[model samples]
Target: MMLEVAIKHAFGGFSLDAGFTAPSGVTALFGRSGSGKTTIINAVAGLLTPDEGRIASRGTVMLDTHHRINLKPHRRRIGYIFQEGRLFPHLSVRQNLGYGAWFAPTPAGRQDASRVVEMLAIGDLLDRRPGALSGGEKQRVAIGRALLSAPELVLADEPLAALDEERKAEILPYFERLRDEISVPILYVSHSASEVARLATTVVALEAGRVVAKGTAAEILGDPAILPAGAREAGAVLTAHVKTHHPDGLTELEAGGIALFLPTVHAAPGSRLRIRIAAHDVMLSRERPEGLSALNILPGTVHSVRPGDGPGALVALDTPAGRVLARITRRSAQTLALSSGATAHAIIKTVSVAASDVGAAAAT
Candidate 1:
């Protein structure tokens, strides 16, 4: 599916002139809070009308200011999941989900109630009311409701923003499962680098209401020029296969012929996983250092070394395990005589990689 949106609008002294196209899988609209992420999503959802341009999905034009074509929110086959679950207080979980399906213009008559229920792991909570469920459970119910509607696309606007850290963590795997299992494409809006790293297949980076960048996850997220949330978030996301689980509760991952040790995860052997190693966590050496605490040592040549945003510089290394970036002080970089094409070893500690920082590397 292809979602094309081009919109122009002004509100509260803020001007929004945004446009982008998203292909199949999850395409994240990423930026700061006021960068017009919601404005574009609303336009696509038929909630806001643009002064000009059109919104189309899979060849069907939802809104066209030039042609004077605008579809009502209900008429547009798009499912919206807000930050809050917004379930009816009086309605049971099943009832709330049923309402979503009931409102669909052309319901999937052969209801896949059991399938959705299992997919979201909400079968146990079906009889409970919204007031009785926890935040994560409520969101799961909400997602199930949206899926049951059988919409052509799902628009998620900061779906995890309102949840606490634990709740957010609890819900992330489910989101991943939905991405892998659901047929409908998702246009996810988020400001979180971790979430985008884990979930997005494509990314449309917005800045001051304009699309500053758009590309595949690896292409966009791997760019050192793109500002990550923090130094710890600065790194390339790599796709690797789970080689095996260790007795010490760690899993060995194989990426581009290199082995990465991570915390034991639910993924089994041969299953793919995404891992991110912070640039700051990476230490470069001229030669293989002996007796180091760091478990992973990669052999690579310096691809490029360039000045970074803050006081440090970004050194791009072409490793057997794929490209990795290391952030080092300018002084250290100069002292090491670092330059493009220099051979080096990237040393990374095994425990420095946290579970929250790792995402599924393969996009659905």
Candidate 2:
């Protein structure tokens, strides 16, 4: 499934003008609060029609100003998952999921409840009420509910914002399962950098109601300049597979020909994972340094250098593992005579790779 949006609307003092094309998989609508992220979602959902422009999904027009084709919210067939689960308070998990199927316009297209339950791991909660479940379990049930509706598109507005870090971690794997296993395209909204880095296949970045950037997660997240203001956590995401578990309490992962050692991972060998390497945690040198405490040293060539207004500069490097970014002082960059196409070695500490940043079972 694919979604195309191009619209402009005025709401009191805040005007929303945004556009982007989202292909199958998770397309993250990322921006700070009040960047019009929710506004665009509402437009696609047919709750708030745009003053002008068009919105379409899978070649079906949801809204068109010139043609006056505006589908009602229910007719749009777009499932919406709010920050809260929004499950009926009086209903059991099974009944709540059944409600999604009841409203589905096409009985043939309605997703099998058993399949969605297995995919989201909500089978155990099927007999319980939403109040009896944990935050993570509630979100999973909410996702299952949306999927059972046979939606062409699923819109999630900061679904993890209400959960604490632990609950967020617990629920994220289910989303990864949804992104990889499900056929429906998902429009996931989030302002969290780590969430975008770990979950998004494509990123649509908004700033003050405009699309500042839109591309694959690797392209958008790898460039610090495209990140939102105060987004100092800008980094590159590399695809790697678990290679082995050593007796030393560390797991070995391989990306391309590069090796990454991290604290013990629970996944079995050969499982694909996405590791996020923060630019601030990386240091680039003109040549490979010797006798360094850091265990990672990858040979690479300088791809680009972006000097910030402050004393820092962000540098991009093409490494064997993947594109790696480094944030260093302007003086350090100048001292090393760094420039585009220059040969350098990226220095990274294995310990700097956080266990929480490793995505499980994510497609490459």
Top candidate when judged by TM-score against the true structure: 2
Q: List the residue pairs that clash in candidate 1.
A: 274-361
Per-residue alpha-carbon lDDT of model 2 for 182-280, expressed as tens digits? Answer: 777899999887888788988998989999998887788887678753447678888889999999998999998899888888889998888888889
- lDDT string, candidate 1, 1-364, tens digits: 7888888998887789888888767889987778889999988999889788889987789999989999999888888899999999999998999998886666545248798899888989989999999999999999988887888889999999999988998898888887887766799999887788788888898877888889876666667776534444567777889999999988899999999887787787988787766788899998999998788999999988878667798888888777788988888788888898899999988888867777665543
lDDT of 1 at 333: 84
- The models' CA-based lDDT, in order, is 0.84, 0.88
lDDT value, residue 337 of candidate 1:
86
Quality of model 1 by C-alpha lDDT: 0.84
| Best lDDT among the predictions, by candidate number | 2
User: RMSD to native for every prediction?
Assistant: 1.9, 1.7
Off by over 4 Å in 2: 229-231, 361-364
What TM-score goes with each of the models?
0.94, 0.95
